[model samples]
Target: MSHLTLIEQSPDPEESKRDGQRHSIADRLRSMGQVRAGAFLLLGATLAALAWANFAHGSYDGFWDTHLTLSVGDLQLDFTLHALVNDALMAIFFFSVGLEVRREFTIGELTTWSRAVVPVVAALAGLTLPALLFVLVSAGSGYEQAWGIVISTDTAFLVGALALIGPKAPGRLRVFLLALAVVDDIGALSIIAIVYTDNFNPAPLLIAAVGLTAVYFTRYLQSARGLVYGSLAVVVWLAFLASGVHPTLAGVAIALLVPVYRPERREVEHALELARTFRQSPSSEYARAAANSLRESISINERLQSSTAPYIAYVVLPLFALANAGVQLNAEILASAARSQVTWGIIVGLVVGKMVGVFGSTALMRLLRVGEFGPGLTLDRLAGGGALSGIGFTISLFIVALAIDDEAVQNEARVGVLIASIIAFLLGAVIFRISDRLHPSEEIGRTLLRPVDPTRDHIFGPVDAPFTLVEYGDFQCGFCLKATGSVEEVHRELGGRLRYVWRHAPLTRFHPNALAAAEAAEAAGRQGKFFEFERSLFSDQEHQLPSHIIRRAQELGLDIERFERDLRSPAVAARVRDDMLDAEAMDITAVPTFFVNGKRHTGPYDAQSLIRALEQSAQEPQPGSSA
Candidate 1:
């Protein structure tokens, strides 16, 4: 879905986690685990529900149907276990979804029309065509109103499925999918609010509006912001519930009102300063302030997401699956489902219709030159992702309860949803297998080995800049030193249109000090001075001594002890080794190798040649792109 974003590729690019940040290694690994574990948990829960319902049908029904009561002062609210999961718990889940949606619109992929157009159009088409297909297939099914079931995509499942599918160079595709998923989520939440509510009451809605207003203004509160927001959220939810609107929408309203922003550098520095003080003094009071400062440095939307994500992934959604997926299967029910148009409609809409809507719209946009996919996100991967978009699980099951009150008919829709999800996964798997095989790494010796990671890579321009120039050069090589001027000249001319990346390919065979110099550069990078250190190294390319390296650090005013330690550390050495390994993989045994927009450049190394190559790369269609 995000694969549709980027105004270019809609993928996550979290790619709505897409302003193009992988964050840190810990965050990336955590997110990956959460996505995978959530998907697998859902799968396991769905299977467990199905198995339990069939084996112990009465108990399954009894457990979820048991009513629970909550009393707040004089007010009393009663809910079945199923209702509690669906309304109260899922509201938190929806709130988490809303945080992501708001973040994307504010600073993620949907921040600009140029970045958001394709995904918005594609998400709309994805929603539209599915509804159309559902109506066409189940015209006489009496459950036509339930077409909303297939209008949403299960993004978590889609992303997790992609991880299992293991397509080559999935970074771009993943990002694009993430971007589109953000838009798709917006559509789904909107559908929930607009299509499902009945017997709308104006008075309570007015109260909800006021609560939402309070929520908006609470951001300005200097203290007790959380307490005020929590109270207002309850007020809004109660108002919506009383007004006959979905109470879960309160989560979204509150989330939208909560402010979101990237961590300001100045604030981060302040937190770091506090951290240093805490480290020296080790006082509880300093610790408290430091912790609070660190927390405040990040946006509340992110903080809330972080706090809530574990519960949503591990508890909320699995319970949802257990509650919603328990459809007791019998011969008669299975037979009726097979013959039921409602079942068939859900199947057709999700499996076939979602693919047609997502992929077709993407193709149309590309043909019209309105937008394009990112590099390494081939048509095959796009198609595969499109197919996976059909795996509509949570929402489909959710709407079955809302749109169809007949338990038997709900069972049929659930059966359709499960079957459609299976088919979509299989279809995506097949497409990935065929397409990835068609484009192997061996086919392109001229392409960069890895995608640009804004956090890790030494980048000199905007990470999302359309054109990227990657240079793999040895620091001590005379020719490599000479090319620095050319690189600078091109960056000066291209401005924001180009991002320049420098990678280490230290030719130790030719220059004995090159590897040490590469590691030294990385050590300087830890102190945020890689480029500056690089220029100093190039200016005195003949410096072949350890003392000279230390002298350069002294000259640059870097922390001498830390630099000295990092100069000997394995991580710094490994960082340099990574670039060396990439060079080896690309079969580069030379002083300087350059890649423009992931494609290696051949011929002259002058500023004019490099700029011309960059311009050419910008104009040319990248592999896996639908340009």
Candidate 2:
């Protein structure tokens, strides 16, 4: 036999193989308890971000504002204060936004004209009104630059606020808000491109234009590759950056140009033709001849789009948020922004203007007979809901920093954002309270904001195991090694009744190996050794066992040959990629997270918490029925 077929490899199995695998009661309780702990941890991180920006390291308030230079010999990119954040980190955010835009325009809620119009109109109003208001108020020499500040809405902050409201929000209202947001985002992009670009260079603009055209013309490329788009996007961003237009706009341009529609007709016809050829002969030689032709005709467009979306969403967006959202503030800056009209205009524009513009535009859309109006909501409720648009803190702050070069302008803008956001929240709360008191309706339940269900297909399998435990862990995590004890305990305690499912919540910023680790584990699972391989993975903790783990798989009596070959397969990488998509859909932000019997858990579990969860699960009925 050839050397290629002789290597020992780990077995590949499905997650179903581990179904009903028993686990300890202690692991169950710990997993359950950590759900709340995870929430606290998430909250703590948010608070820490705010506090760190506002208080600690007051001396370096201008650290992020300081100029940084990146140069390649004669080629250099220099930016200062907030431009770097908006143009650099925000480019990744824009990239994510671009992906979302493509998804929506292609096949999402915005696929149809009726679905798209209301939001587009509402987005227009949301964009135009606040910007006009800001411009009107801050009519100084550089005041016009602040126009984009009001036009942009922070999707993260808006979505986060809606999540906090839980059951209080209606489904129609949520849909309306989402549509309006899409519109608002488009408006923001326009403002950045049209209003923000100062001293534009024609050469770079021309190059960017050509790059965009290339993406559009090659839209039908059967072998359309993400790397092509990525590389071109980088080039466009660089050109735009050098051209004096914000680099982030490159993300939008590249995104718009990338075609989302698949060449399905050709693909299907080709596949059929290949199938016909295969049916004619059973010989390996014939099979190879037919398969090669089919493979050649096979387009990677679907795979390309699928692969790109998750990278932009989970990897790029989060990293951008982490890098750019760390704003430093102090008493002086806060006070300055409190008193500055330009700052106040941005604050008022985001908080008051956003609410008014968003809600007003949405209301107008309803009146204009454009899309359906939100049910169970009156004008008062709509107006109140609009106040929540003040949650544009992130995008507002980002734009404010970009709009002004002066420290005073930026500080004042930040203050306005803070104040307006708080006020908006209060206004929204009051409206919700009044709406609830006057016309109580349970039609819109609290589950609307819950994480998207992952078990719809029994995607993992039925949890008939005695100990039902779900883990929110990244495969490349070291701390999860300590977590193995809890997993083992639950299996031991509740044999056959326990089901453990692994989830991907990789932290790309902290650990680079996480994505690969997840793929490896999934690949191992394909060969029936997920649990064993996962144990080996967690055992190392620091995640230093990629090659060694493969070597160890050989020792574990695995088919090291097939296993090693499959480990590097795109299918394996795609599995990890799929998990990442699911993770994003489910709103998982951190790693080492767990959920037992529908309850969330975080970090490593000790004995006591584990037992408590299992005991509690014992009292509760099985989770199949709707709660």
Each prediction's Cα lDDT score? 0.79, 0.58
For model 2, residues 477-580, the per-residue Cα lDDT tens digits are: 55455566767776676667666676555545456566556666676776777777777776674733355556657756788777766665545544454444
TM per candidate: 0.74, 0.55
Candidate 1 similarity to native, TM-score = 0.74
Top-TM-score structure, candidate number: 1
Q: lDDT per residue, candidate 1, 94-197, as tens digits?
A: 89988998887775667657657877887888899999999999998777899899998887688788877747546556766777888888888888788898
Worst 10 residues of 1 by lDDT: 1-10
